[model samples]
Target chain A: MDIEALRQQYLQQLQTEEAAAPPPVTPEAVAQYVASDGRDDVKICQMIASLPLDRETFETSVRALLDIAADKSVGAVARLAALRQLGSAEFRAARFGPFHAEYIDLLRTLATDEDVEVRTAALERLTLTADPHALKLLSDGLQKVGDALVPAAKAVQLLARDDHGSALPIFRTLATEAKGQVREEALRALATDVKSAPLFERLAANKDEKTALRHIAAVNLKNISPPRFAKVARKLVLDENEDDKLRAAAVSAITHTPAVAEKVVTRRFATAVKKLRATTRSGALKSSIGRFSKVFGEG
Target chain B: MVNVSVKFPSYDSQGRAFVTWRPVEVKLTLAGAPAGASNVPVTVSAKSSAGGGALAFATTLTHLGTPSINLNLPANGAPVSVWVGGLYPKASASYGDVVLEVRAAAGNQLLGSQALMVRVRKNADDLTAAERDRFLSALATLNGSGTGRYTSFRDMHVGGPPDLEAHGGPGFLPWHRAYLLDFERELQAIDASVSLPYWRFDKAAPNLFSRAFIGLPDSLNRVQFSAGHPLLGWVAFGAAGIQRGRGVGPTTVPALFSEAQTLNTGGSLHASYSTFRNMQGNPHGSAHMSHGSGWITSPPTAPRDPVFFLLHCNVDRLWAKWQWAAKLHDPADPRSFTPAAGFPPGHRLNDALWPWCGPLAAPRPTTAPGGTLAASPMTAAPGLSPKCRDMIDYLGTVAAAHQAFAYDDVPFQK
Candidate 1:
């Protein structure tokens, strides 16, 4: 088949009937437009699967084809076909370079699509292109996020791995006003690795919150470091005369977590024992001591 | 604002000098209250915001009934104030330290204060000798031999005539209150210093319950309960029903009458001397009601607050009073253990009957319609049985017996 010639012919057919755009030349036209093998079965499958994603009902077709491609283990060609369905082919161009430059808009649209999978794909493609501007687009898309902000926040969290500074604000806002269940989940999203330490400190200082909130914050902070997290824990646990219940909570929070237990366990446990002995008339302090001892001993 | 001096008697306990107080003489003024002051109606709240806090009771003060607020003490002493809270009808922020004062209406007036600080302090401890005796007296009344069953009550459920229709149900709230009051009156007549501290279970429980259930204390030590612990579940369900179906508070947060209930009764520590258990436990004793009416077996903690000793005094006293009231109604009345509602009609014999019910549930025991014992103006126990004075005398007799047992134990020859 004269594949390139047929493609030109369809392009002219579409232009000739400008008002009607010739209703997206059928599957036959599509195969002709992209140039397919008439004989080799594997080549025929690849040709059928590699159809452009910008034709009429291309999104719907591309979605169904992608499902098939995924099930059948289609490779880079299917990824390219899926990328072309985007409003801008920015992701595709980034994946394949200026060879597919005419499809830049489709990729750009995918970069900002509400679908988490689409946005993630676009970001992954941008990573390959070494495009500094694509990173800005990811950051900009995050900036104006609406209710989709939860997924947006998750994506930004990943973005933080490379560009941590830009995603920090979104993480902070979510950590603050999100509902109790939401705040709990957001903690995991925002407090990955060692970078979540400062956010933990900010949450710890929020007095308007209930003891449980403060308790969780102290825990997250302790997860990040040694003497520093231990120091904050010490202030709370060693105070001796604070709300004993709250103090005990702070002690348990700071002493038991995975990261800082080794560094501060002995000191924190000893201090907790001493303070509990000195102040608690209710025997709660001593009970707290046993808890710390177990955690430190186990650790 | 009317400023009045409310005085309470100062007493010595184990070398510690303590004075008690109650909030009364509340003056209603809209001038300095929070926003919507004019729109707000007068509110009267008597509460204790102590370490183990609770709202004692609340009611609108319609008007000043008397200049002297009478309080009762254990033993036969004059009714006097341990502490008192009152409003200053004539004092204001503009008046510069001219606060209202509360003082003992009688006696040396050793305890007197015009400041809210002193009132709060006095109300905080919740223990006193008078309170102890009051509870003791109630126990004595209910447990007295001649007056010892549920039907001993000849009067209305409360102060009205005894009606078989009402039975002992919610209508018994006021009835129980009156019974407690009668017991309180008797305690006062014995020792005027004794007074009853009304408890508001709502405010006192928040911190306690939060610590017990939500916050981590020790799981065993925590009052770690939900709306599922059978008895408490009933209370929660009942209170919730009252609120939702009947427009009560959104939450069925019960008030804590005791500090001990919160701190001690957990896994690690067994403090049973707390007020929460005592107050919550009272209604539980009614077999006619639910068995676990939430009555506590003991105090949450030991060496309980001096207040606990007094609170129990009234509790024990009320039990005694109930016994006396029940017995006075029918000496042969055996319906004590029967559920308020008997078995299905036409069943001549009760499916379940107390030991005494076999005798009372017969035509022989049912007095004629106009018979003297049946239609007598007085519903008290027979003169041959026990008079009120005889009952009091018997209580003293029991006291003597207990004292003798404590002092004179026989030694076994080894």
Candidate 2:
């Protein structure tokens, strides 16, 4: 007997049955299926997603999903399904009122779980809570050391979206301290917040900062205020002692705004090119100058 | 029966005397001697060459400022004992045969003699199959004694202390170095041939979780000590119990630390308390927190896990490498003179490491107001204060620490 073939046939048959019957689409029915003995997480998740749940039933459905998500005895796939359902916009909008704290607590615990998928799911779900505890949870997760870091970075993005000022400290720390994609995400998150302009300006101007961090700061600074950033960018481009990568960041940032580009290019083009020739003697800086001239309509 | 033999680790791999172990003691056992042997005066002498040549270095063994003492024999002819101490190799001598002679008190008659060979080599790594087996055997002996005996001692010392003192401050690296040495001494007592093997995480070796070392996770996605493995039945000293937790996903090693970041400056010993200490803590603390869950995840109870020692051994190795390659020196600050709050008087560079007091010891724990332990000295180890010296003496001892061993790979930045 070929057990693999038999299993595939059985799965196809179940899919056919699922298509014909299409599981009930009521909130009570979703909750019932979630709590039922049958361990078909995919079918249950599909039913919950399709349901047009009212606020009262949506709350009830969230309670049932929380139970599955928090249960370590349940398979990871099943728990992840419950978490995704809870993270959905319709379910998140339903007020838990008295159960809000309990719901947040469940998500916080799952955020630190040993399983990576569960931790990712919990982080995604917490982004919707908008509670102060959710912010604290995201901040604490950012400080964690290992695999959860990438997911934590994602959570920071969500938190920054909801309340930029509150997530500023974490963004600043990540911008300077973190490496690779995590750092990029943090810089992007900081740039998205208009309030982070001063911090970005300080980071861009600091000579002791890592070149990568300074570059990100310059790029992000342009997003908040191009004309203000142009002054810092122009200084970086003209400073002979500055790192080449940093000068490139300044050039790239300054070229983005037409007004700022026209003024800085017309003012510093020749001196900047001569400095590049005397110090680096590379075509790289010359090309940047030519690019800036074209943007300023003086090429 | 008359037996004369060199110790189990007669010669280290490089064929030199072990560095940290000084004055390698030679044991002499005598049986069926004459009646007056009980009162016989004996003198033990060592010479550099095999046949009674001039002594290359000092051959005298002394205790309490007195020259070689007489051997005492039981009337029943049970073996009389004479310990030959101070057998370290000279600076220029890579390998030499030391001939030890025992002469009679009156006529200078030869009673017994033996020639011993001494050797030194780099520290052990788990990559070698035999080294791994030896390590597991030593760990089994240490672990079998139960977590309460050893792990509890570490937990109490670090967790109870002048709180921030042992960690997040200047004493972090030095204190942990002393701790690993103390634990290594215990392991040597269990098996003289055993040395603490470091885990070179920079190599990104995937076999660290092999059954020969800490086994990989089981089918349930749980990391348990393998069934029938030496550490399988071992119980945890902390609340985490005996269960092991294996790290998953990307390796935490690269994220937690980079050699470039840790050894950035000829790190100052006199700078702010956070200067070198906090820099070391970046990777050190991150590794502890990144192990996911289990005893290794938390600072206070981390010693309960067997993996903690291997992780710390690598950290100690890095410090040794930094001291050597960077030519960085420890601070001679007089203000760094205060001792650990609860432990003893040894926080200064010249001070002897308290608790494990002996000659050639590491420095004492430095003071940090909030980091100091709150326990009374009376409740701690007795006579601990007297055993410690000032920082100067402590540095002198640790300076020679690598004389007994070296790292297989020093990760020096070009």
Candidate 3:
């Protein structure tokens, strides 16, 4: 029961009124707009459950929503709305769970719909099930830049979820050839594969590289190879000439890597930190000291 | 009358319960117990000071211990200590609720009673059934189908007129801190035992996304809750329900960066506010993007979905943990903060945050959403016109700044 139900239970009642009821909704009023042939699929979806009519009308309304989802001529908004209404708690609870297989079939068909929204929504829903069917669609789409169902980057992102782990070639190609969100996501996917450790090291160490990508490389280096991460991190933290922000990331990596932090960050390193604190004007360099101070017993 | 005072060593200066899950040490000193009342057995228990079910399971202690305990009050009247460790996750709405009462075990003679101040924000997954229901009902009431006070919050995040001050800058973390606090305080105003619960998007949160809870999504990405779900009456701009679903990204669970990855966005063990703030692109931006087609995919339309609060709460939690771990509270310390040079007005350290401030001219959003900041029953450090600098020391660690809220995982430094 809600807090409101607790009211008036005692002589010293803590009575609070219930919130005002939402203005009445007339599902029937909206259902009148639907055509028997489901040409008005959008309106049919809006009031599918609360039809107030016989079971046949409700069933027809349900079928209309599903039909709209598959009908390419209906376009994105109406099609997506139909799928949404069919997947809603009301419809799902109305024994729509049995349509699970049928729903997947509809999604499989829509995954390659001409409209980006339709295609993307289909792929996203399919990705949730880790369905093998999406694997081929995403993979085949990856090889083509023009006729692709979705952008190569989005395809790589969704494909990275594959249970088969078969997207490494695609990830490598995109990581090298792509830019922006695509390359970034591809690099993230590549980081998990040990085979790409060397690439991570090169990017992490290259000073001329974009700081964002370098940061990703520097962090993943710890997991890829602890000794290598320590060596790179130690050099960066001590490099007073380096960008203070990047140096902060280096200091962070060593301090957080328990396995190598103690071995690499010795008493001499503590002296260096103290000296750096006294001389370095970089706030990022100074800010990186707190966690290091605690772990190494430096005040 | 038997006299006694309760002191929870773990409580703050305001004497409120900060950690609800753990056994907070409560010590009682017998001040004016009659001399005739010598070494005798007494029962200690917790009840609602205002009388209600808000404190329902409060007496249910951990380790199979009963709510009321039988302990002997020594003749010497030395202070007696008892651990108040119950899994009571709800926070009191008003000043507070839970009160401690002592009675003579024999004749059931009354002693003294004191209210236990509880006001804590908790994890959504950790909430008990009763606590979850209270939070949901209070949220529904506050929304009142989009016509209630929640519109103020939904409007605050649209981020157009004020130069998007709340995002893409140093103020993002601090601004959202105030936003979530204001929203949680409103919920508490409706029912004291309700604090906003956060969704740990890094983890697979079954409880948070279930139909019985925040609601699951349909095929079209429309969120669906079970029938009679309190959130059913949810309305935004007069429209009902929320629009959200899994993104076209890989897997639902790992699509966004994990907390470990996010905490070290610099790809190291830790990072500075300057570095970690870059998460605006990954986990933070990616988390929003992972919702696919929904109001949450972008800032201007984000808060329309109630999950926006939960999402931001976790973001704030990360900052809190980072601040705590690195001792990054002192705004005076140069190492504590470094906004990009020429960061927008509100993003600067001492500048007043908007929506919380009184209306202003062209530079500010043409319309302020919630009036001034909502007052917290706990503390007044973060005033109505809070500045970016005020939010840094949230735990009141080094500064007696603001202890308005506490997370289950982040312990109070005090």
Ranked by TM-score from best down, the candidates are: 3, 2, 1
lDDT of 2 at A295: 40
Clashing pairs in model 3?
A: A219-B267, A252-B269, A253-B269, B91-B193, B92-B192, B93-B192
By summed lDDT, the worst window of 10 consecutive residues in model 3 chain B runs over: B52-61
For model 1 chain A, give the 10-residue run with minimal summed lDDT.
Answer: A87-96
Q: What would the per-residue lDDT of candidate 1 be over residues B153-237, giving only the tens digit for each residue?
A: 2221211112221111222222232333343333333333334343222223232123222121221111222211111111110
Per-chain TM-score of chain A in candidate 1 equals: 0.39
Question: Candidate 2 lDDT, tens digit per residue, A135-185?
Answer: 665666666633333355566554553433676777778776787656755
lDDT of 2 at A199: 72
DockQ of each: 0.01, 0.01, 0.01
Question: Stretches of candidate 3 above 4 Å error?
Answer: A1-299, B5-111, B115-119, B248-251, B265-268, B339-341
lDDT of each: 0.31, 0.48, 0.62
Q: What ranking emerges by lDDT with the best candidate at the front?
A: 3, 2, 1
Global CA lDDT computed for model 2: 0.48
What is model 3's DockQ versus the real complex?
0.01
Tens digit per residue, CA lDDT, model 3, A180-251? 767766775564566777887888788887775676566555555668778877887788777676776566
